[model samples]
Target: MDILMIVPASLLVFILGASIGSFINVVVYRLPAGLSVLWPPSRCPHCLNQLKAYDNVPVLGWLWLRGRCRYCKNKIAARYPVVEAVTGIIFVLVFLLFKVSILTIGYWAFCSWLLALSLIDLDTMTLPNQLTQSGLVLGLIFQIVIGFFPEGSSVGAIKHLMMGIVGAVLGLWLFDAIALLGSIALGKTAMGAGDAKLAAMMGAWLGWKYLLLAGFMACAVGALVGGVAIALSQRRFGQKIPFGPFLALGAAIALFGGEAILSVYQGLFFPVT
Candidate 1:
């Protein structure tokens, strides 16, 4: 692509991603509360004043307002801009990786929901079953549709979809069992139920091959990050740590880079250790 075309295309993708991220913010905030996401316009959570059109213009609006509500001047959560920026970056990467394919769209859609669920779980330590169930259906549809396309074969897409469903169930049940066992062993719950549900969502979307990969990656990342934080803070062992964000990260990676990762892993550890 020409330099001029590249800049324009990149800017467009970034804007679109940020716009979607704005909608995702609504879903994240309201879905758990059973609120109508579309009915009410965006408003100040502090003052409940309906936002003007300018206020809803993704990242630019937040930057213009200096991250404060125009009416109430309440400090808006910095997460708004952060989510938008992150989504924009991810979109640009997706465009590069898939180049106008349905794979791009499907993964983007998956990430949108995952973004909401990750944030909600971060805040409340709960994963809504509705989101996970919906994601499973969507992932199945995406797999079958993509399989039919010329580049890939649809011959076994259904089988993969079944594997995904089974992976989801197994992931959730295994986590639950571990939680139960740890509870019995330690006299307290060792993991949050929300973590199990979120893993199920990952399994549903990624299928067994990538779902297990994601689970391992998520656990590894969570341990490394959480360990560093605990060590720096001098926190006690077994302190509560949020696991949803790591799971989301893992799922995103699996969806986008699973094949490459598997190739690398096979190169390193092939011949069945």
Candidate 2:
């Protein structure tokens, strides 16, 4: 809690987050390929050369190597470092916002999952059940555990758990309903089952109120991005764009600032106690 302590803690959190990000890269690559994440160690895809300890040192390793495989001189994607940096930044932000708390740790894990899911969806247009389903289960379990704690039960623990359950169900149903309506309007499939499951996972973490906020934000951002993509000729008018990334973005925003944002909106519209 001391300022001096805060500085050291933040640095430690960032380093730990970057390390986790390195592992997440493995999950992103192997989970999609049905490969064991642990059986084989990290390797350069182009050369199949096993990465050395120095080569696997998060962001610094890539920079030190000039983004090339040392053994084969093959180019490594910049995304590797970017992912590490983003994860590090997010971890620091979580610490700053929540300090040392259960919520901080929970949200840190949630963000990591969200980051992996977003990238996977962008690359493959799919959200794996392994991630989303497990995330939902984990979220529910976390909420239930928190619910039993005295600090968390001021508003009734059972109510908290039920909210999570309702959130998941509502999120799943909302996405499915939209998909059905979109299919009817477009005369084709408009969304995938993965997205619905993803929504449920997010809802489990965020609960019903914030989940709705996330959904609204996702729609707004998705529309804006879609419009821009069409204008830039990056996508055809009728082409489908991945929605999971936007949903992930929305959930993140809601997780970090949903209550503050809602307060601002309420103050603007109601202007009354």
For lDDT, the strongest prediction is 2
In candidate 2, position 40 carries an lDDT of 81
Tens digits of lDDT, candidate 2, 1-273: 899899999999999999989988999999999999896899999989899998899999999999999999999999999999899999999989988888888889899999999999998999999999999988887688678775656456677678889999999999999999999999999999999999999999999999999999999999999999999999998798899999999999998899999999889998897
User: How far is 47's C-alpha from truth in model 1 (Å)?
Assistant: 1.8
After TM-score superposition, what is the CA distance of residue 174 in candidate 2 from its true location, in Å? 0.4
lDDT of each: 0.83, 0.92
Per-residue error for 2 in candidate 1, Å, reads 5.6
- Tell me how far the alpha carbon of residue 194 in candidate 2 is from the true structure, in angstroms, after superposition: 0.9
Tens-digit lDDT string for candidate 1 (45-69): 9999999898889888898899899
Which pairs clash in the backbone of model 1? none
Per-residue error for 251 in candidate 1, Å, reads 1.4
Reference-based lDDT, residue 60, model 1: 84
In model 2, the runs with Cα more than 4 Å from the true position are 151-155
What 10-residue stretch in candidate 1 is worst by lDDT?
150-159
